[model samples]
Target: MRPVVFPHWFHRIRFRCKVCHAELGFKMRAGANQIKMTDIIDGRFCGACHDGETAWSVENCDLCHSGKAGLPPGIFGGHETLGPGRW
Candidate 1:
């Protein structure tokens, strides 16, 4: 299956770490969550906010899943880094 690109900047801009990690209960480490389409569809994991009404819907797969492993350097798209930038 394709991997999900968790947009840290996007999330952090609108929410706090505790919102997803504590209130929504997302795992900190990668590969820790047994994420499945069904789980997301059932309002679990990413589905908590991506339920269309809350945030974007999960069916809009292309927004998150690029199907490509880590993007190459120089492709940062105006950002200084892959995530946190120059901080």
Candidate 2:
């Protein structure tokens, strides 16, 4: 699987640790959870928050799959610049 770009700072702005750790059952350590895409599409793990009504829909693959090309601006507070230098 490709690397997932989970912007913690973004989630932190809205949620606390318990929200994901205690409530959602996400392991504190990364890669501890053997998350399967089917689980998500079937409404589990990330699906708990990304079921469209909650956050961005899972069907929107790029939302989770990153580095393919183009990420939304303001994702990193818009600090990251794109392309060549200014003229």
TM for every model, in the order presented, reads 0.69, 0.69
RMSD of each: 5.2, 8.5
lDDT of 2 at 43: 80
Q: Cα lDDT of model 1 overall?
A: 0.66
TM-score (C-alpha, index-matched) for candidate 1? 0.69
| Shift in Å, residue 1, candidate 2 | 6.1
lDDT by residue for model 2 (1-87), tens: 345666655676577768988988888764467777898888887889899997888778876777444543222321143212422
Q: Model 1, which residues run further than 4 Å from truth? A: 69-86
| Candidate 2, residue 23: how far the Cα is off, in Å | 0.9
Clashing pairs in 1: none
